[model samples]
Target chain A: MVHRISLVGETFVFQDLKHILASASLLRSGDELAGIAARDPVERVAAREVLANLPLRHFLTEAIVPYETDEVTRLIMDSHDEAAFTPISHMTVGQFRDWLLSYAADTSSLEKLSPGLTPEMVAAVSKLMRNQDLVSVGRKMRVVSAFRNTQGLPARLGSRLQPNHPTDDPDGISAALLDGLLLGAGDAVLGINPASDHIGRGMDILWRFDDIRQRFDMPVQSCLLTHVTNTITMIEKGAPVDLVFQSIAGSEQANSGFGISLGILSEAWQAARELNRGTVGTNVMYFETGQGSALSSGTHHGVDQQTMEVRAYAVARVYSPLLVNTVVGFIGPEYLYDGKQIIRAGLEDHFCGKLLGLPMGCDVCYTNHAETDQDDMDTLMMLLTAAGVNFLIAVPGGDDVMLSYQSLSYHDILTLRSVFGVRPAPEFEAWLERMALVDGTRLRMNQPYALPNFRAGS
Target chain B: MSQLAQDPWGPLRRYTHARIGLPRTGDSIAGSEVRALQAAHACARRAVHACLDPAKLAVGDSFIEVRSQAKDRSEFVRRPDLGRRLDGPSIALLKQIAPAGPWDVVLVAADGLSAVAVERQAPPLQNAVRAALAHTWRIAPLVVAHNARVALGDEIGALLGVRCVVMMIGERPGLSVSDSLSLYMTWNPHVGRQDSERNCISNIHARGLSTGEGCHKLCWLLKSARKLGYTGVALKDESTNMTLLPETKTP
Candidate 1:
C-alpha cells in the first residue's frame, strides 16, 4: 500500500515501508514544533488551529499575578464572619477597577465587576494592596533582597544553577554553585525568607492582633511586627506564641531559613542583641510585607521604592541580631490573587528568588488578599512543599488560602498520625483555638502588630 | 623509589600519604596557624569594636590581647564569664560612670557571641543611638556590657530604673560571616522575662548592618518604642519623622 502524509515542514509520499519510516520520523521529531514551518496549506491550517487554542495571556498572567479570589473568599468565610459585607460600597466599581488595573492586567478586574465583594475578597484585596505597596517601598529603599530556601535536596539546587546539567546528580552541582556564590557574597548578604503568614487564616488570624494593637495603642509600622509582638505578649502573659505559627505557612519562616522579612529579622535580632543585650524567644517567625503605607506630602499612602528600601535596610540592620528567623521580599499588587491561580505563582516567584539557600527558607507565601481559594492554598502547600515549600498562609474565608491553611493544619496532624503513627492533632487544634483569641493572635515571631493609628511617618 | 610513589601529585593513596599522614611543620607551622586563627579572631573583634569609635583610634585601643589571665580589673579578655557577671571593681566603675537612676531609656552594648563583632560594630551603633536619642528627646545611658544578650538591656534598665532599655549584642557566628551584631529593646528590663516584650536591631557589622544606617534605625526604633509605650514583637513603628542626611552631615 502507498500513503501520502504531510508534516509541518514537508510532505512525504511513501510505500508501506516508507509509511513505517514516516511514523518513526514523527515520533522522533515531536518536540520540533517550535522550529517547524508550515510548507503547505493543510499543515499551516492544522498548526494555526493548534496555536490558536493555546492560552498566551494565561501564561503571562499566571506568572505575574497568581491569586484566586474565590479561594480568598473561602478563607475569610472560614475564619471571619462570612456574611460580613466589605466596604466596596465606599468606592465605585470603576474606581476599584481602575485601581486594580493600574498594576494588573485587564482581566484582574474580574472580581471588581461582581459588585458585592465578600469580606474574604476584601481582605484578600487589602492584603494584596498592602504587599504591592510594601514592594514599592522596598524598591525605593534600595534594600537588596536576600534569600535562601529549605529544599536541602540536590535536585532543587541543580535547578537553581546548571539547570541543564545532564548528570543524574545535578542538584549536587547546584549546591556547590550556591556554596561558591555565598562564599563570594557571604559577608555582604543577610538571611532568607520564612513566610510566617501560614498560621491560621492570615487576615482572620491578624484581626485579633490588630484589635489588640488598637486597644494597646501599638504603632502600625508592619503587620508582621505586630503579630510578633502580640505573640510575644501572649507568651509573656501566659499564652503560647508557638500556637500562633502552628501548621500552615507559619513554619516556613520559623522553621529555619531567612525569607524576605526573616532576613531583616535576623538583622534586627543581631541589633537587639548588640544594643539591648537581649535574646529573641524560642518561637521564631518570618513575616512578609510589613509597613505597607508611609506618609508622603502629609498623606498616608503606599511607600515608594527608595523610602521602602531605606526603611527596610534600616530595619534589617537594626533588627538583625534579634532574628529568631529572618523574613524578606516585597510582592506588588500586580501579583495580587483574590480568586485566581496567579497569587500562588507570584508567591513561588518570590520564594524561588528569596529562598535560594537556608535551612528554614520555604515558600511561606504571603498575600494580604482577604479572599482566596482553599484549593489553591492546598495546591500552594503541595506545590511549594513539593518544590520545597512547606509553609503557606491565607485569611479564613471562602477563599482557598484560608481553607488551605486550616485544612493543612489538620492535614499535617493527620498525615503525621497516619504516616508516623503519632497524634499531634492537638497542637494544630490548639493553634486554631489560640488564633481565635485576641491575646494569642500574632502569626509570626519577631514581628509586631500594626495598628490603624500607627503610620510610618517618614 | 617507584615513580608513582615518588610523584608529588600522584593518585589518591600517594597524595593522602604525602599530605594527611605527614607532619610537615614544627614551631614555624604552629606560629603560622596561630597567626591565622588570631587574624580571624581579630577580624571579628575589630569589626565589632570599630562600631564603638569612629575616629582613627590610637594603637592602644585597637590592640586587644587574648590573654590567659586578667591583667587588671578592666581586662575582659581573660575571663568570658567575668564579662557576663560584672566584677566588684567593674560594678563599682559602672556605678561611678552612670548617672542617677529612673531614666527614660538606657542603651547597652555587649560582647555576645563574637567579641570581634562588638569591637567593630559598637562605635557606629553608639553614634547612631546618640543621634536617634537626640531627635526623640529622651534621657539614655550607653553602657558597655562585656557579655550579654538582648535581654541584658532590660536587666540594666531594671537596675537603672529606666522606662525602656535597648541593648546591642553580637550575633551567632554564621558560616558565611562572623562579627555581626544585634540590638534588642524592651518597655521594662527584667531578667529571664518576656521575649516579645522587647524589640531588636541586628547585623551591625560592616558586612551585615552598616553602622551609620544601623544607628539611625536604632534611634527610630527606640523613639517609636518609647512613643508607643511597648516594644518587642507587638510594637509598631509607623512614625515617619526620620530625616535622611548625607554622610558628611553626620558627625
Candidate 2:
C-alpha cells in the first residue's frame, strides 16, 4: 500500500517504523506514495492507516538501523529548525529527493523559496542532489543583483570592459574604449588594471573612463584595478571613483600578501560608500579570485583549492560587491592543468558562490602556456551561461596583452546571446536599441561609427 | 634620496620590487611618490606591447633571426602553441644552418611578454655566459627568435642537434620592474618537454641579479647540467658553494 506520510515533527520511532515497512515490501516507492496522495479522500485515509499500523521493527535479528548515521542529513535537521527551512529539513530523504526533482522540473519555485533560504541551507540540501539537480538549483538562485549606473545585471548577461593597455595613455585608452562600446560591450563596468602602482596614474585612468562614459552618455561604471588603499587615496583626492577592485585569496596569509585584511576591506567598502559616486545604489566593490592564489602566496593552510575558494567567497560576501568573478583558467597549468579541470573549477566556483549569496561571474580565460584553447573557453562560457552567470570579462578579441592571457571577446557576448537567447541587462539593452546597435533583441553592427569629436585625437 | 623624503620603513623597499612604504603629505601621497609610480607603470606598459627589433638588440650578424609560427603580437598572446614552435620556413632555415651531429649547447633569445627585457638585459648576460664557456663547449649560432615563447628553443635545439638549450626570454612585466629577463635551461632539448623539465633563473635585471652574477650562476648550472645530463628539479643549484671561494667572488 502507498501512503504519503507527513513526516514533519515525526519522532525517530515513527521514521524507524516507516523504514521497516518499506524494507518488508509493505510500502511502495515515493512516486507511488505521491500518486496515492493525489487520490480521493477515502483511499488516502485508508493508505495512511495501513502505514501507521505496520510493525516498527523486527527485533529478533537484533539488527539496528539508524536514520541519523548520515552526517549531512543530521546536520540539516539540527540546523534547519528555524521557520524558513524547517519544512525542507523535516522531509524524508525520499520525499526531499522527489521535491528536488520537481523543483528542478520547474525552477520558478526558487524565487518563492529564496526569501527564507540561506545559501548554507541550500548547500546542505545540495549534498543530497545530483549534478543536474545542482545545475538547476544554481540556475535559479539569483541572490544578488548588480546595477551599474542604470544597467541592472543578473536580470540579463552582463559584460565588463577589459581594455588593458600597457601605458595608461588617454589616446590609446580612448581607442580601445570606443572599439569595445562600438561592438556593444562593457555594460557591467569599465574596468582597467594599471601596470603602474602609482595612485595618480590609476586615478587618471579612472577619470578618463568616466569622462568617456559621460561623453557617450553610456550608463556604465568605471573601475581602476588597484589596491584598496590606493583606491581610498584616489577617493580622498576627489578622483571620480565608482568601484574599488582587489584580488583576494582564500587564506589569511595570502590575503596579507595582497596587503589586505578583513578590516582593510571593510575600510575600503566604507570609503567607497562615503564617496557614493555612481548612479546605482551602494555595493561599489569588485573582487577577483582564483585557485592556487592561496598556495602561491604561502597561505593555503593545508586546505584544498575548492574549499579555499568557497572561504574566499565568504570574504567577498562581506563587501556586498557589485561583482565577484573567478579567473578560472588564468592561474596556470600547475593547479588546473588542462581545459577539463578548468571547466570543472568554473562550475564549482559559480555554484558555491551562488550558494553563498554572491553575484558570481566567471572569467573564462587561460594563459598560453596552459593546454587550453578557444573551444575550451566556449564550453565553459556556455555552461556558465546555462548556470546563470551574472557577467563576464569582454576584451577586444580575446587577447589581453597587458595581462598576458586570453579571455572572452565582443564576439563571444554576441555568441552567447544568439545561442542561449540571453540578452544584455534590461537598461543596457534599451541603450543598445536606442543606439541602433541591436534590433528587437538581436545585436546588429552593420557599420562602424566614427569616434565622437569631444576629444578628437586627444 | 633626501632624508626628509626617505620612507620611514627604511631599506625594506630595497629588498623587493613590490610597492611598500612611501612618504606621505598629510592624508595624501607626496607629488614625487606619485610621479615615480607613474613612471614605473609607463615602463611596464611599454614593455608589455613593445616589439623586438633585431638590429637594436645588436647580438651580432652571426645570430640568425627567426620568427615563431605566431604571425604577430596579438596572435602570439592568444595562441601560445604557435609561439612554442618555428614556422615551416624557419624550420627549413634551421636545417640549412646546422644539419647534423649534436653540439654542446645552443643559446636562444626570445621576446616573451616583454621585448624591452630581451633588448635591455639579454646581450650583456649572453656575452658573459659565452665568454665563460668558450673553452669547454661547442656552442651553435645564437638564435634571435621573434614572438617566441620559452618552448620555442626546444624545437630549435632539436633541429640543430644540440645537447642542451638555454633560452633567455622576457618575464612577465611587474609594476616595479618591466625590463626583467629570465633564463630557462633544458638538457637534451627536444619538443613536447613539459615546463617542469626545465630549470629557471629569474630576476636577471639591473636591480636584481647583475649580468656578471647571472652569467656565473648560468655557467655553474650549465656545467653541472652537462655532468648530470639533466637540468630540472633533479639538478639543484650548488653554485652557492662555488661562490663561497674567494677567486669566484662577484663584484
Candidate 3:
C-alpha cells in the first residue's frame, strides 16, 4: 500500500517555501523542490520534508501544509516576542478569520484575544476582509479605553455650551450649564466657547465648570474651546482643564489661523496629561473641524473637501482625542450649499472617521444664512443616530447666539435617546440616574430637578 | 524664557486694531490677549443684536423713520431680499415726505448689521459730510430705514428722485471694532442698481477712519462719482495726506 498526501484546506500557503526550507537547513538529497512542477508531486515532497523535520503536534490536523510549513510556523511562533502568538500561529488564515468572527459575535471573547493581538495586526488583516469581518474587527479596536471604560466605541452624545451673554457674566454661564444638565445633555463633554477671548475669562469659565462638577458630583468633563495656546495658559494657571479644545483644519495655513500645528496640539495634550484633571483617563483633547476652513484659509492643497476632512481625521487620530466633532453645515453656503449637501457631508465625515478608528460625532447644525431649518437637522440627526454616532452638539434651544447659528438642542438629545434607545456614556447615565434627571429610560423633564447649591456670587 | 522679554510686536499693535503681537505665554497667547479677543467678540455679537433707536440717531426732524419689507430683525437676517425694499407703509411715507425732484443726493441711514454703529457714528459722519458740502450739493431729507440692508438706500433714493445717494449704514461687526459705520455712495441712485454701481468707505468707527476723515473721503468720492457719472470701481478717492484723527475708543 502507498501513502499519499494532498494539499487542501490550507488558510495560508507560504509562496517562498523553498527559501524558508533553505534558511531552516531542512533539505534532503534528491529533493529538487524548486523544479517540481506538478501540484501533487510538489505537495507530497513539501509535506513529507516538513513532516520529517518537525514534530507532528506542530501542524494542526485540520490544516494542510503545502509549503515550508514547519519553518513558517516557527516564524509565527517566534513572532510572539512582542505579543503572544502561540494560540494563533498554528491556525491558518481561514481558521483565524473564523475565530475572529466568533469572538466578535460574542464580545466576551474580546479579552481572550486581547493579550495576543495588536491593533496593528488587526489593522493589517482588516485589508483582506469584507463587510461584517471588517466591521467586527473595527468594533473591537475603535473604543479607546483610556477614559473610564468607554466599552469600545459605543454611541455617545455631547453639546457645545455657547453660554454667551451680552455681558460676559458668570451667573449667565452657570444658568446655561444648569439648563443643559437639567435637560440631560452634555454627556460627552461640557465644551464652552467663551464670548471673551481673554485668558482670565477663559480661566474663570473653566473654574466655574470645575466647581459645578465638584459641587454636584456630575460625571461630565469640561473644556474651554479656545486657541490651543490660550488653553495652554489656562492649564498652566491651575484651571481645571479636562479636555483642551481647538478648532483644527486640514491644511497648515488654516491651522495657523487658529494658531495651531501638530506640535502645538501635542503640547496641549502634554499639558492636559500633566494636569490630569479628567475622571476619564488621560485621553484629553477635543477638536472641531469644518469643510471649507482649509479652502477659506488658502491651504486646501486643491483637494476636495471630503478628502481634506479625512486628512483632519488623521491628525485627530495622532492625539487619540476623547471627542472629535465635525461641524457639518456650519461653514456656510459655498461649500455645502443646502440641506442635501450638508447631510451628505455629515454622513461622509462620520463614516470616514469611524473607518479610521476614531470616535466620531457630527454637529448636526446649520448657520442662519444657510438655506436650511430644523427639519434638516432632524434628518441628519436621525441618520447619524442610526449610523451609531458617538455624540452630537447640545446647545440651548438649538440656537447658538454667539456663533449665530442653530445646532442640535437639548430636546434633540431626548428625541434621539427615545427613538434610538441609546443612553449617555455609562458614567454619565449613572450620574443622571442618581440625580433623578432621568426616570428609567425617560428624561424627567416635567419634574423639577434641584439646582446645584454652588451659587456664582457665593 | 526671561520674564522681561520685550514684546517684539508691541509697537506695531499700536498702529492697527487688527489683533497683532498678542502676548505669548510659552507658545500660547497670554490670557490678557485672549480676554481682549473675547471682549471684542462679545462686542461684535452685541452690535449685531443691538436695537436701532431712531430717536437716538438725531439725524433731524426732517428725516422720517421708515421700515423695510422685513417685518423684524430675525426676518431681515434670514431674507436679505426682503430687507432691500421698502415696506408698503414706508413707501407711502417716503412718497408723502420727500419732494419729487432731481435732488443732488439722498442721504439714507440704515442699521445694517450693527445698530451701535448707526447710533454712534452715523450722526457725526452725516454732520461732517453735510458741513463739507453745505453750499454745493442740494441734499434731500434724510430717510432712516429700520431693519434695512444696503440696497434699501437705492429704493429710498429712487423714491426721492435723487441723482446720487450716500447711504451711511453700519458695517459688519469685526472682532476689533463693533461700532464701525460705512458709507455706500451710488451714482444715478435708483431701483435695480447693482452693488458694483456703488462705492464703499468702511471702518468709519471712532477708532478707525474718524467721522472727519471719513467725511472728507466721502466728499472726495461723492464729488468724483458725480463728475465721473459712476460711483463703483470706476471712482477712486484722491484726497492727499489725509491725517487720521486720534482713535476715540467706544465702550
Identify the leading candidate in terms of lDDT: 2
What is the full ranking by DockQ, best candidate first? 2, 3, 1
Give stretches of model 1 more than 4 Å off: A1-458, B1-102, B135-138, B237-243, B248-251
Q: Per-residue lDDT tens digits of candidate 3, residues B135-235?
A: 89997777788888899988888787788888888876655567878889998778889887889888787657777777878888877877788888767
TM-score of 3: 0.54
Give a tens-digit lDDT track for model 1, residues A368-438.
21123234444443333333322232111111111111112212212222332322112222332333312
The candidate with the higher lDDT, 2 or 3, is 2
Ordered list by lDDT, greatest first? 2, 3, 1
Model 1 TM-score? 0.30
lDDT of 3 by residue, A326-424 (tens): 999877654665677687677666655665556777789875445566678899888777766777886755556456566776767777877777777
Distance from true position, residue B3, model 1, in Å?
A: 36
Model 2 spans with C-alpha error above 4 angstroms: A1-131, A149-155, A446-451, A454-456, B1-125, B128-251
The sequence of per-residue lDDT tens digits that candidate 1 reaches over residues B153-202 is: 55466656678776667764432346677777777666555676766766
Q: Which is superior by lDDT, 1 or 3?
A: 3
Q: Chain A in model 3: its TM-score?
A: 0.69
The lDDT per prediction is 0.33, 0.67, 0.64
Find the candidate with the highest TM-score and give its number: 2
